[model samples]
Target chain A: EPEVTQTPSHQVTQMGQEVILRCVPISNHLYFYWYRQILGQKVEFLVSFYNNEISEKSEIFDDQFSVERPDGSNFTLKIRSTKLEDSAMYFCASSGQGVTYEQYFGPGTRLTVT
Target chain B: AQRVTQPEKLLSVFKGAPVELKCNYSYSGSPELFWYVQYSRQRLQLLLRHISRESIKGFTADLNKGETSFHLKKPFAQEEDSAMYYCALSGRGSARQLTFGSGTQLTVLP
Candidate 1:
């Protein structure tokens, strides 16, 4: 079965540096989402992207966070300035349409902001 | 606030044993519930949804709106069923955004 794929399975960065997590959603899927889980915490939603725009966002996704669909296949989450608390497992997911609620998630990228 | 809660952090059972993973949710209006599973070294994937009303891989979950619970159950636990199980909930007539539980780690010892 086709699945969402993410690059850089793990990322390490300085506290003040920027990091971009990349994801390639399944072809033919429309809705894309970003979620994260801090170690030992529940997975939290970050943002949802559709039609090249954001549909929803959580408080954790502040100004430092931005998502872009630079290409037909790539969806990226960019953090302008990382904080220690930013370390977490970032997951990318996609669904076929808005009517359907099922989402397929990628393996996730472990981000560590030291 | 929307929330999903899985009370058990870990559950261990022997092969052929019955297993139940409990999930509870707090949502005001109509709710949609789902169970997702993640095997070791595998991506999280949808196991089953309450709306489907169908069983998958011998696992089934029934949504109890009266009790705000959706518990996953399987009559016989197989080693392959050992994985991290997460319960999720979404509200009706709104965004499909999901609120997930902390998750339950199911281990079926051979």
Candidate 2:
């Protein structure tokens, strides 16, 4: 089965530095999403992207966050200035055009901020 | 506001025992409920959806709109059933993002 793939399974970055978490969603999916889980916490939605624009975003997705589908396969979540609170495991997900609600998640990327 | 609540943080049962993982939700309109699971070191994946009314891995969940609950149940628990379970809810409107419960850790001892 095709699965969503995320790069840099683990990353450590300094506070205030810019970081980008990349994801390659399922090839045929039309909707992409980003979610984060602070250690021991429930996964929280960050944003969803479709049609080269953000379809929805949570309050946690503030000015520091931006998402882009730089190419056909790459969906990225960039944080302009990382904060300590930003340290968490980020998951990428995708689903077919009509059934986007049923998302398939990737093996999250663990981001640690120092 | 919409929310999902899984009261129990952890549950442990012996093999061959029946298991129940509770889940409750708060939503006004018709809600779509799902139970997702994550095995150790693995990605979160869908275990079953209330809409399908199907069982997966001996697990089943029934959506009770009146009580606003979708509790997962398994007739005979197996050791391999140990994992993290999350209950999620989606509203009827557009762009209905899922709201998940805190999750329950189920451990089926051998």
What is the TM-score of each predicted model, taking all chains together?
0.97, 0.97
Misplaced by over 4 Å in model 2 are A99-101
CAPRI category for model 1: medium
lDDT of 2 at A40: 89
Per lDDT, the best of the predicted structures is 1
For each candidate in the order shown, give its overall lDDT on alpha carbons.
0.92, 0.91
DockQ score, prediction 1: 0.73
Q: Model 1: how far is A82 from its true place, Å?
A: 0.4
Q: What TM-score is obtained for chain B in each of the predicted models?
A: 0.97, 0.97
Q: Residue by residue across B50-103, what tens digits does model 1's lDDT show?
A: 989999999999999899999999999999999999999866633477789999
Give a tens-digit lDDT track for model 2, residues B1-110.
88899999999999999999999999877899999999999999999998899999999999988898999999999999999999998677455567889999999999
lDDT of 1 by residue, A81-104 (tens): 999999999999988765565788
Chain A vs. native, model 2, TM-score: 0.96
